[model samples]
Target: MTTIELDTTKLRADRLFQRKRLVGFAIPAVILAYLTYIFFAFDLPGLAGRANMDNAVTLVSDSWSHKVHVTRDNRSGEISYAVEGERKGRYPEGARPAWVTGDEVITIDLGGDHIVRYLPENRTEIEIPNFPLIEVRAEGRSLVTNLPDDLPGWISASNRRIGITTPEGRITLTGARTEVFNYFPGWELFWFTLDSPYHGQSLSKILFGERVDPARPNISGAMSDWWNNAMWRHKDVAWAIGETILMAFLGTMGAAIIALPLGFLAAKRFSPIMLLRAATRRLFDFVRGVDALIWTVVLARAFGPGPLTGALAILITDTGTFGKIFSEALENVDQKQIEGVSSTGAKPLQRYRFGVIPQLVPVLLAQILYFLESNTRSATIIGAITGGGIGLMLTQAIQTQKDWEEVAYYIVLIIAMVMFMDWLSGWLRGKLIGRKD
Candidate 1:
């Protein structure tokens, strides 16, 4: 009998080993099959072939650098110098950059021996260190260039336009205008635009030296100029950030308020009715399963794009989430505590207020505070769709394509805002629920 029992145990162990081996091999085989399907489905190789590395490099460079545009109208022969080609950043009348010389024939000295000369009567000349001199003349509605038939990759010339790209700068000649872009490090006019009195003054001089603006005090005038800067729009950014925070706060708190009662209705222990519990659970699933982005789009159409719409979207989505979580917490409550309250002849509402709430407070507050922090980031994305908050400014900056520095600034502010929310949530959590360790 002992021999038979041992033989039976050995047979079972061998079968179990075979089953485990089959599972291990099958899991990897399934994963490999899925990955193979995805590789062909995504067309990754075709995407790689179509990507432009030069444009990617230029976009990355533009994020950290600024460009000065020197444009001369071919028809009127009028020259203009501007930062990033914006009207607000245009140089004051009759004022040109130090690198440019000659009034009649404007000479733009791009560093590293690259020079561009804008002569009278729609004539232009570009000289690079190792390359031959390029001369282009714009007449009527066409561009005349001394470019070879077999030109290099950097130069693209046609009857209507001539484009030259170099390491130091880029020069483009067209029938309507001749433009030269000189690259420089850092964001130009970030602190103050050309119109501001404090444009060129050093920080130390502005703080301690004589008044720069004759009409107002040094510090106040400087502060006002920086705060209301037209180019950077500091005031607008601050207001947008405030709106984002307000959206997140309203959405998270409002969801918590609405979810608490719904949570009780969903909890099987609190609501004995099977139909009611199932309906509440289904409602929670429907709201949350749709996703916040979908809610944002749907609500935006109903209410129009605004912070309030984003707030309502967040509130609706989070209400479902909070209801589910709170219901689970309610279901796990100590039955002994509820029974003790009932023995004291306490009413149903009072029993819940005293017995159930104390137990669920920590879990509810923890979830709410955690969601508040997470929702802050969610609100930024929601605001972008709803056309409000810092996300709108970020989207606008990205759409411009030339305002990458502004994009970088907005990204920094968004990160700082998230960090601040994280810290605030942690503090609130600690205050409400005593720290664990």
Candidate 2:
């Protein structure tokens, strides 16, 4: 080749290499610039400053522990002991906790060196190790305290109220009441309320020993009390769980049943008309693209909130997804089996049943079962919006901001439900379609 031609070829190769190198460096530089913008745009640097660690820490601690409230009414001079301050968990008449002592002046020992005494005439005494004795008096619409102006971080005081926090417990003095909350490690009164005769009985005593309640048999009474326990509401929770599962089942199955026929209409092989195929495909996109939660809100507004509303929302959203998937599967199906079925003089519906459907069963079952498990979790969130299932109970518990233990309980139940659904779906797949692994 000529020298001029050789020089031109070398120049072209060098320019091509430079262009490729520039493109590679430019792509990452663009990504880096975008991420840099996002970091400040999202205010990530100020996230820690915006967080309330005290409330977060308290919430985490409350989820695993229970507290008993020792409340004294300043107006009536009446003292009451209740678990988590719930009236249903209040101590019976003439009954009190072991930690409480004294007849007229009630003394509460909060396990460490923390002690609280409900003095006469709406006065309270608090003693903590390494600190001076703090006294407070709750009068009408105001508080009188020995707390200094230069107070510690653990103490919050105002003219009308005073709050003290220590490792052992928390104390609050107000114009209307004086309350001391002593925290314990486990959920109290979970099995039976204070009204139930089985509240203090041991497992062995209730099961094998004498009758705990004279009104009913030992086992039967114990079972009944636990089921109807006002604090836990086991029956209500069970029904909510059932409702969530029903929503998932009805929605998933309903979607699959409706999508199967619509799939045939969207497939190029089955649908000869371009307009019909395009319309069906667009319908699938329109429904699926809007999202399940959006559909949930719309349906809830129209139909009103219920389990059926949640189910219909799920059905509408999943039908679009299943239609798109089924249509694609239909388009890729083997035509030889269809031809053989036709040669046997099988009519359209019969050919579809024997030929098209048989080929699609494994795919159909696999997708259906997988979606059923996914929809189970989706139903939980949908139930929250529709006011129907365990999700509603969970939302209520979380909103209360005091019942973190119940929130924890509902969360654990939801995780367990999802795990069970996962196992059940896998088992069904194994039995009906044969497991791949």
Candidate 3:
């Protein structure tokens, strides 16, 4: 009865709530309807068609694909596939060639009624005579010499399994050192394999035979090649990396030399003179505020390209960073030591040399090592801007769109180099900072 005189305001609020819910539902429904119309209206098929067409054109025009390569796939065991020309035998065009037509294909008989045939078309097929399924030879660093009569062609030999064939099986050699693989036409085994002897052979010779491999999956030979050449050959990559490291080293070292003197001038504990401290602090701020890339461009424009430009850029950028860091390091030093040094009538430079530097050097070196790692990558960027070092090579490779092989090479090289630097820097830090027992 009390509520019989319904509060009109509460009823109005309830109606408003219902209206809000309806509006929310209606808004989403309208959005869904619009989306549905767009999905149906837009020509998604045309977009997909255009993308496929572009890929086809690019693949057709690419010259590298024409190059013959060793192919290893799950279906086809280690086999040779021609990049260009007509198909041979029952093998589909470019399916897998036995031996390149012109180039000598090696045929070997390992006995046990096994026939290794190097087909005229650059491929190897091995038949176990009575065996039902084909047997693909395992690629190994070691090779056997007995020639199989059923071999389709002359067999070339090596500790590295560059090329070998049989009637129904083929083995493409692969390992840590040797790299050969092929990716075009779906067979990736030949991409980084040793260059095929019949790489430039006629189209007919390209399709000697195809092998079958029920076991073993296709590995990225190109990536393997990069790993071996760039990373495994750590010693070789170290030199280029050293250049970058040297740049960072010199940059950090030179910056430290300059920062030490200036940082003292900037610190209040050391430089009680307000004007001197203010100027030094402002200078530090100004230098550190600018981006390293901007500094790189500016110095490159001013000095032209080379290690000198890269070193100078690193020097300029690091100087600001060093000044800021060294100042903080200086500020954090125990003040009691300064009073002790001063109480002994030690000169300002003497007091700083004894009191400030002992504490600051450890911090400075830690920061430097960190900066060395940081600047190693920066040096690559700086080198690209200045047209120096491997970075320059990488930039050119990327610009030309030359197969990503070279880019991969340089990237692996840089990563290896950075890892080495990290190891070396850590060792040095331990030696310098760790107390001798």
Candidate 4:
């Protein structure tokens, strides 16, 4: 009875809640419809295939033991087998072996093909080639070269001759009428073809392709060695990185000197002259407005490319930034201290030197440390444009494409350098402005 009728307001609120629930239900349906449309709306096979191919390249399959099983549900008249190994494998069939067993390990002929219809179970297969044995004929010489030999060598006897060595391990050559050979090393084949007048590819252009002709010299080994060679091992890259750091350090120091006077001139309290303060502030703004990279391009063109150009650009950019920041710090200085110094009949310069400078020291030092860290990155960027730093080598490595590992190496070096700079900045800040915690 005290409750009387249901409150109309409570009923209204319940209706709003129901409306919200209905709207929420529609959101999932809309999202589902959109996803369905996107999945079906375009040809995505190429994109999907590319992603899968990338996975395939980096994938490492579990090592398969040499023991392989070949069974005949019922032997008709023929048999076949495949030989797979560390470097290469092949399937030889039709011209079947007299017999086969799962426990046996053997080598097959390179590029030999045979058909297998020997099993009623519909098993069709052939023996793989001997591990790393490639049937190679160089010029007029016919030989089965052991891949792991210090230099490739052919079997003294028949193509079925036994024994081969490679970097991986030793393998016995097996197979009747099957020849084993390692063609000239891959790099030799490449250099051979390249040196040939008949070869159309230039050394630089071929480098771009990273293709080593099979007929050339030890191309693969040479390429592998080259890619793995450390660019930083060279004195030039070390010199470049050193110059970049020097540019940032000296540039920051020079800008600090330039900014101190300009900053005081820009501060109304410090200058006590409105016109001089306004003019200095406007000049600071004008300089800092342009990006550091733009400055690099201008100076590189104007002064020519070198470390000097890089340092100059940093100096110009930081001067403006430091000027503005220092001016603000000066404006925030406590007036009471200035008055206390003035009451002692100190001159204006003396008053500022004794009163305002002490408070401004921590803020200025903090800003300088931060700017130094920032300029380190800027120096690398400037080096890139001016063709003089580790960045130049990085760009070259990328352009060559075959030097991807070198690219990886340089990237790690740059990241390490940045981490070092960050540590230095933190230490300096703690020393100059005491740790907050």
Each prediction's whole-model lDDT (CA): 0.92, 0.92, 0.60, 0.60
Model 4 misplaced stretches (Cα beyond 4 Å) = 1-232
Q: What are the per-residue Cα lDDT tens digits for candidate 1 across 363-437?
A: 999999999999999999998888999999999888877788889889999999999999999999898899742
lDDT of 4: 0.60
Ranked by TM-score, the better of candidates 2 and 4 is: 2
Local accuracy of candidate 4 as per-residue lDDT tens digits, 233-347: 3456667778777888888888999999999999877688899899988888877888678888898888998788888888988999999999999999999999999999999
TM-score of each predicted structure versus truth: 0.93, 0.92, 0.51, 0.53
> What TM-score does model 1 achieve against the real structure?
0.93
Worst 10 residues of 4 by lDDT: 60-69
Q: Supply candidate 2's per-residue lDDT for 110.
A: 98
**Candidate 3: minimum summed lDDT over ten consecutive residues — where?**
209-218
Candidate 2: C-alpha RMSD after superposition: 2.6
Flag the better candidate by TM-score, 1 or 3. Answer: 1
lDDT of 1 at 36: 91
Report how far off residue 178 is in candidate 1 (Å).
Answer: 0.5
Per-residue error (Å), model 2, residue 344: 3.5
Q: Model 1: residues >4 Å from true position, as ranges?
A: 1-11, 341-345
Off by over 4 Å in 3: 1-98, 102-239, 343-345, 435-437
Best by TM-score: 1
